[model samples]
Structure formats: structure tokens, C-alpha cells
Target: MSDRMRMMVVMCAVALLAGCAGGLGGGTYERAEARRAMTVDYGTVESVRQVQLEGTKTPVGTIAGAAVGGVAGSTIGGGSGRTIATVLGAVAGGVAGSAVEESATRKRGVEVTVKLDNGQLLAVVQEDEGEGFSPGERVRVVRDGRTTRVSR
Candidate 1:
């Protein structure tokens, strides 16, 4: 394939990989969570701070990048030179792809330390969906068996 075509494929793959990312914010929910009973606790926000939510590390990004790189590298030269280029390109692309995916999916998060009505203190971190929290604000601590989130 032509260099342009190969580049287009790579771009498309990256886009698809990005689309695979889902929100980690308080408002977002997985399908399985629908109608499932959850526990809720009332609390006052004791402290609110900004944090970074790390990106996902999935095989999809590495594999897609390697494939795109191998195809692009194959067009570089003839015979043995092309083979070496493909191998090197794949390796580099895989690393680059992983980084790109992580950077692209990374999000700003908030760490909310709350003082529950029961006198217990707990902290929860979740994507900062722009609904800012402040100290002394009333919030709800929602919990499922697997996860927890602080919401207003």
C-alpha cells in the first residue's frame, strides 16, 4: 500500500482505540450497573483536591500500532532492508502507541475526603466532570460492591 494509505489506516486505528475509552466520572455508569442496588452515605466534604486519572493500558493500542507500523515500514526499502525496517518500526510503534493511548485517555480527577454522618472519614477519587466540589459541601457517597464515587 502507499505511504498515505498506510498513514490513514494508522490514524483510523488510533481513533478507534481512543473511542474505546469510557468515562470514569461520577455520572457515568456501565450497563451492568443499571438497576443494581447500591449503598449511599451522606457526608460533608472535608477536603477537595485535584488528581490525575491514569489511562488504560490495553493490548489493542500496541497491536494496532504494530500493524500500522509494519505496513508503513514495508514501503521503506527493498528486501532485507525493508524487513529490518518493519521490525524496528513495529517495536517503536508499539511503544509510541501505548504512550499515545495513555496520554489520550488520561483525565483530570478529584480526590474528595469526606466526613460521613457516622463519624467515619473516607476519600474517593473520580473523574472531575466539572462539577466542582468544595470543603464543607454536602455530598453523597455512593457505593457498589466494586466501586465508589462521591457525588453532589
Candidate 2:
């Protein structure tokens, strides 16, 4: 494979990943932050449980890996050996890439158990990109539809 083709494969991989990625952690998606987003839950944070934010590895990662692997494998040999290498590379790359993408995108998240003012306790887990919330800190749980965020 030529350098140009390899570049294309990489670019395509990046573009594909960009679309499926749900963002590193927190951000308003498709909806304005204040649009119908009311303070659904106001509480004192009882605990901030640290957890891993697993990332989704769909077809994008697999396809991207296969493309790059195929390209790389094509350079291995001529005739049948090349063909076998390409196939093996694609399979290995797909698996490895999926894992790599997932690992790369994995982030720090927290299961925030809040003590609502009404004496009821509920836990909301969301990605924590440094949205500081300490135990006993007052925070707001804003909700719009199925989406929710914990913020100071």
C-alpha cells in the first residue's frame, strides 16, 4: 500500500471514531445546557465513588484496525504469504485496535451518591473530567430527558 492510501486509512479511522465517541466525559450533547434542564435533584454529595468509564468499541475501531492492518500486512511479502499476512493482520489489528481504542478513551468517572434535601438518597454516575465534587459539597443534578449531569 502506498503512503497516500495509508494516510487515507488513518484519516478514515479518525473520522469514524470521532462520530461514535460520546465525548471524553461531560458536555452538552445536541441539547443546550439550559434547555428544559431544571435542577431535578439538589443534594449534598455523600460520597464520590471513583470508577472506570469504559468506552464503546463498535465497528469503527474494528474497521479502522483492519484497514491499517491490511495496509501494513500488504507490505510483508509477495503472493500467498502476503495474502495470509493481510488476513492475520486484519484480525489481530481489529482486536488490538478495539482494545486500544477502548483503553485510550477510558476515563475517570464517579458514582455520586447524593443526599437530597428531602432526605432521600440517590446515586448518579457520570464521567468526571475534573468536575470537582467533594463529599459534603452541595451540588446540582440537572436533568433533561435521559441525560443527567452533576455540577457544583
Candidate 3:
């Protein structure tokens, strides 16, 4: 056998051995399978009440401010000016009334806290009873697209 041929055989054996040992350092040999897990955060439902608001309600602060301003504005004028001032006052009162009703309506709702299985917490205000969720229970969290929904 020629010296050059023997060297070539030795190099090929070494290369094969190196290839076999490539994945020995905690490296995975195959692609890992991905999985989906559910996480539920728990919170109590205080009350399941219906909150209704007329479409015409205005905010309270605006109404209160307008009332005070109108009263003050009325004081600045008398007689026909008073009539003008009263008209302005009536407009202001209507605005104020609507605002007050809106604020009151806005205050009616339920607050719930949901805890995810991943230890993340969320606070939610839901108008309807969040279906299948209870005050002290574990819920399965499922991811739908980009949003998370909880199920009992």
C-alpha cells in the first residue's frame, strides 16, 4: 500500500468519528415539538347586575361647573339681561343634568381579577357575567389568536 493511500484512509475515519460525536454537548438532535398550556387567574364576581345608560347622559363634572358658572353669570346682569342670563342658565342646567346622569351610569359595573396559569394577573371590568368564571375557582386559559379567554 502506498503511504499517501494509508494517510487518506486514516483521515476519512477521523472525519466519520467527529461527525458521530457532534451532538454530544447537550445539543438536541431533532427539532423539539411545541405545546400549548393554559393559565387561569382567579377573581371574584361581586355582583351580576344590569347596567343601563341612556344615550343622552352627559358627564357630571361638566354639568356642575356649568351650573355654577351660569348662576354666577346671571348675577352679573339684571331685567332683560336677567332673562338672557336665565336662558343661559337653562342651557347650562340641561348640560349639567345630562353629564350627571352619564357619570352615574358609568359607575355601575363589575370588576374582576383573573389570574393566569403562568402567574400573570389581570383586572377586568365586564358588563356581563364572564361566563364559566367564579369567585374562587381555577379556570383554563386558552389563547385564541392574539387574545386570551378563560374557561372553567
Candidate 4:
């Protein structure tokens, strides 16, 4: 690949990585009216476990990787040999790019088990934003649509 083309691909990859980091982060909640606000439930955290947060895997990474890889692989040989190398490189690069995007965007999170005031027990998981909830600590559970969060 030409230096110009390589530079373009690198820039594209960097842009995609920045975009992949979008969406929810720790310690932030959407603001809504009282009626629209999440329904609140009270409980005590019974246990906590650290966990890995999954990042979104989009087609951008695969496409960028394939483009770059194909160009690089095309330099390997002539005609049919080049074609075969390009295909293999594209596939391998696509997979590697997807994995890299996921890892780079992943965040640290925690799973919390709680016991409700009504004797019903529950567990919730969320990003740990320095608001660590220990066992037996009082917590409030809130639900907005299908998403729920636990807070002090």
C-alpha cells in the first residue's frame, strides 16, 4: 500500500475507535420528569463482583480492517497469489479489528446482589464509577424502561 493510503486507513481506524467509545459511561443517569423518571426501589447490597463490560461490535471496524489488509496483502505477490493473500489478510484483519475495538471500548463494571425491603432478593449490575457499594450497604434501585441501576 502507498504511504498515503496507509495514512488514510490509520486515520479512519482512529475515527472509528473514537466513535465506538460513545454511549453510556459510569455515574450518569438520564434526566426525566417525575412521571417519566425511573421507578425507584429500595434494598441493601448483599454482595458485589467485578465484571467486564462488553463494547459494541460494529461493521465499521471490519470494513476498515479489510480495506487496509487487502491493500497490504496485495503487495505480497503477483496475480493469483496476491489475490489469495489479500482475501486471507482481510479476514484475519477484520477479526482482529473487531476484537481490538471491543477491548478498547470495554469498561470496568460490578454486579451487585441486593435484598429488598419486601423480603425479595435481587441482583443488579452497573458500571463502577467510584461509588462502590459494599455488602450490607443501603442502596436504591431504579428502573427506566428495561434498564436498571443501583445507587446509594
- Each model's C-alpha lDDT? 0.88, 0.78, 0.45, 0.78
After superposition, the stretches of candidate 3 with alpha carbons farther than 4 Å from their true spots are: 1-82, 128-133, 140-152
lDDT of 3 by residue, 43-120 (tens): 433323334323224334444445544554566578899868766865775566455544444423334466655566
What is the model-wide C-alpha lDDT for candidate 3? 0.45
Instruction: Write one digit per residue (lDDT tens) for candidate 1, span 29-54.
Output: 88999999999999999998999999
TM-score of each: 0.93, 0.84, 0.34, 0.82
Residue 90, model 4: Cα distance from true site in angstroms: 1.2
Candidate 2 ranges with C-alpha deviation above 4 Å: 18-20, 24-34, 37-39
Candidate ranking under TM-score, highest first, comes to: 1, 2, 4, 3
lDDT of 4 by residue, 48-75 (tens): 9998788778887777777777767777
For model 4, the local distance difference test gives 0.78
List where candidate 1 sits over 4 angstroms from the true fold: 2-8
Report RMSD (Å) for each prediction in the order shown: 1.5, 2.4, 31.6, 2.8
- How many clashing residue pairs appear in each of the predictions shown? 0, 0, 12, 0
Q: Measured by C-alpha RMSD in angstroms, how accurate is candidate 2?
A: 2.4
TM-score of 4: 0.82
Better of 2 and 4 by TM-score: 2
- Residue 17 C-alpha lDDT in model 3: 30
